[model samples]
Target: MKIKEYRTQFINALTPIYDAGEAESFFYLILEEKKQLKRIDLALHPDLAFSEEEIAVWNSILEQLQQEIPIQYLLGKTSFYGLDFEVNENVLIPRPETEELVDWIIKDTATPRNNQGLKILDIGTGSGCIAISLAKNISNAQVFAIDVSEKALATAKKNAQINAVNVTFINQNILETEDLQQQFDIIVSNPPYVRNLEKEEIKKNVLDNEPHLALFVEDNNALIFYKKIAELAQKNLVPNGQLYFEINQYLGKEMVELLEKMNFATIELRKDIYGNDRMTRGSVQ
Candidate 1:
C-alpha cells in the first residue's frame, strides 16, 4: 500500500481519540522511526509504499495508540534536550516544561565559576534526563543522579551511557535519607509534585501509562518532596550553591514560601514557555 494512503488511515483511526494535529504528528513520528522517511520524503515522492510486513507492525502500534499509550513509550524512545532517551513504564516521559528547566540550568552555568570543577546532583532522576543533559552540555560538571526504583535506575543508567555522559546513578529514596553526605555546586530535581487532586488534569495517555511513583503527591502535602529535598539541600549544597526544581504550575507561591522559610537565598520562580510557573531556583547563602 502507498505510505500516504496508509498515513491517512492511520490519522483517521487516531483522530477519534487525538486531535487531527496530534494524530498527524504521531503518524509522522512513526513514519520516521519505522521507515526512516521524513515528512518531506513522503511529500516529495508521493509514491513510497509500505510492505505488508511493515503495515502489520504499524497496525500493532496504531492499536496501542488507540488504547491511549503514549507514542514515546510505544516507540520505546524519545528526544529531550537534543538527546535521545529510552523511556518505558518505569519512567515518566520527559516533558517540554522540564526542557525549559534544563535550559535555565545550562544558561545559568555557562560562565566559569572561579575555575573550579562543578559537582551536581539530581534527586528523583527518573530517566536521568536532567542529569545526563547537564553533564552532556557542561564540560566540567561531575553529575550524580538518585532514584528509588531499581527499574527506573536501570533505565537512567542506560540513558547516561546512551548520551555518552558520565552520570553516577544511585539507588536510594531521597525521602528516607538523612544527609546527602557530600556537597554539590548545583542540585536539581523534577520530583513527584502532582497532587492527587490534579489527576483529572492529567491526560488519559499519561495518567494511564506513566509511572505514578514519579508523578503524584498527597493533596494535603503537595510539597512533601520539595520540602524534604530543600532541607537536604541546606545541608548538602556548598556555599552559594544553587538548587533547581521543575514544579507544579499551581504551587509556585507555596514553593517560594517553602524555600524562603528554609532560608534558601535568592529564590526565583520562572514560567515555562506556556507561561505557567513551572520551575524555581534558589541559592544557598
Candidate 2:
C-alpha cells in the first residue's frame, strides 16, 4: 500500500489510545525508523508503497504502542543532548528537562578555566545522558557515572562509546555507600524523585512502560536519594564544588530547604520550559 495512504490507517488505529498529535507523531516516527522515509519524501512521492513485510512490522509496533510501550524503546534508540543513546527496559528514557539541566552545567563549565581537567560525577546515571553530554561538550571534563544496575551500566557504557565521550561507568548502588572515595568539582543526579503517590500524575505511557526503579521513590521518604546524595556531596565535593539535580517539580521548596540545611551555598532553583521547578544547583563554600 502507498505510504501516504497508510498514514490515515495508522493514526486511526492509535488515536483511541493516544491523542491525534501524539498518534501522528508516532506515525511519522515509525515511518522514519522503519521505512527510512521522511515526511517530505512521503509527501513528494505520495504513491511510495510499503512492502507487505514492512507493513507487518509496523502493525506489530502499532500494537506495542497501543499497549503503551514507549516509542524510544520501540526504536531501541533516542536522541539526547544532540547525541544518540540506546535505551531499553533497563533504563529510563532521558527527558528534555534533563537536557536543560545539562545545558545549565555546560554553560557554567564551558570555559578556559574549567577546561583544566574538571572532575565530574553523575549519580544514578541511568542512560549516562548527563555525564556523556558534559563530557562531549566540555571536552576536558573527567566524567564518571554510577548506577546500581549492572544491566543499565552496560547500556550506559555503550552509549558513552557511541557518543565518543570518555566517561567512566561504575556499577554501584549510591544509597549503600558512605563515601564517594574521590572528590569532584561537580556532582549531578537526576535520581528517582517521583513518589508512589504521584503515579496518578504520570502519563500512562510513562507509568506503564518506563523503568520504575529509575522513576519512583517511597511516598514516605520521597527525598531519600536526594538526602543521601546531598550528604555524599557535602563530604565528597571539593571546596567550591558545584552540585546539580533534575528534580521533581512538586518538591522545589523542600529541595532548596534540604540543600540549605546541608550548608550548600548559593542554592538556585530554576524552572524548566514547562515553568515547573525542575532543576536545582548548589555549591560548597
Candidate 3:
C-alpha cells in the first residue's frame, strides 16, 4: 500500500479509541521507528509502498493500539532525558516533568556556587531516568538509585549500562527502609504520590496500561512514601544537602508543609510546563 493510503487506514482504525490528531501522530511515530521514514521522506515520495510482511506487522500493532496499549511498550524502547531506555510492564514510563526535575538538578550542580564531587541518591528510580541523567550531565558527581521491584531494578540496570554512565543500583522498598549506610549531598525521588481518590483525574491510557505499584498510593495514606523518604533523608543527608521530589500537582502546598515540618530549610516549590506544582526542593541543616 502507498504510504499516504496506509496512514489514512491507520488513522481510521484508531479514531474510535484516539482522536484523529493523536492517531495521525501515532502513525508518523510508528513509521519513523519501524521504517526509519520521516514525514519529509513520505512527502517527497508519496508512492512508497509497504511489503506484505510489513502489512502483517503493522496490523498487529494496529490491533494493540485500538485496545489503548501504549505505543512505547509496543516499541519496547523510549527516549528519556535524551537517552534511549528499554521499558516494559515492570516500570513506569518516564515523564517530561521528571526531565525538568533532572535539568534543575544539573543546573544547580554545575554552577560554580556548588562544590564539586557531590554524591546523589535517587529513590524509586524507575527506568533509572533521574540517576542516569544526573550522572551523564553533572560529570563530577557520583550517583546511586534504589527500587523495590527486582524486575524494575533489572530494567534500571540495563538503562544505566546503555547510557554508559555508572550508577549504583540497589533493590529496597523505600517505605520499609530506615536509613542509608552512606550520606549523600543530594537525595531525590519521583515517588508514587497519586492518591487512589484521584483516579478519575488520571487518563485511561495510564491507569489501564502503566504499573499501578509505581503510580498510586492508598487515599487515606497518600503521603506514605513521601514521609518515609523524608525521614530517611533526614538521617542520610550531609549538612546542607538538598532533597528533591517531583510532586503531585494537587499536593504542592502539602508537600512544602511536610518538608517544613521536618525542618528542611530553603524550601522551594516549582511548576512544570503545564503550570502545575510539580516539584519541591529543600536543604537539610
lDDT digits (tens) for residues 174-221 of candidate 1 = 999999999999999999999999888999999999999999999999
In Å, residue 240's CA in model 1 sits off its true spot by 0.5
- Each candidate's lDDT (Cα)? 0.93, 0.92, 0.91
lDDT of 2 at 70: 94
Q: Which residue pairs of candidate 3 clash? A: none
lDDT of 2: 0.92
After superposition, the stretches of candidate 1 with alpha carbons farther than 4 Å from their true spots are: none
The C-alpha stretches of model 2 lying farther than 4 A from their native spots are none
Off by over 4 Å in 3: 112-115
Candidate 2's clash total is: 0
Compare candidates 2 and 3 on TM-score and give the better one.
Answer: 2
TM-scores for all candidates: the values are 0.98, 0.98, 0.97
Can you rank all candidates by lDDT, best first?
1, 2, 3
Where is model 1 poorest over a 10-residue stretch in terms of lDDT? Answer: 108-117
How do the residues 12-56 of candidate 3 rate in per-residue lDDT, one tens digit apiece?
Answer: 999988999999988988999999999999999989999989999
Question: What is the TM-score (0 to 1) of candidate 1?
Answer: 0.98
Q: Model 2, range 1-285, lDDT digits (tens) per residue? A: 888778889999988888999999989888888778888998898889989998899899989988999999999999998899999999999999999999999999868897679999999999898889999998678999999999899999999899888899989999999999999999999999999899999999898888898999998999999999999999999999999998999999999999999999999999999999999999998
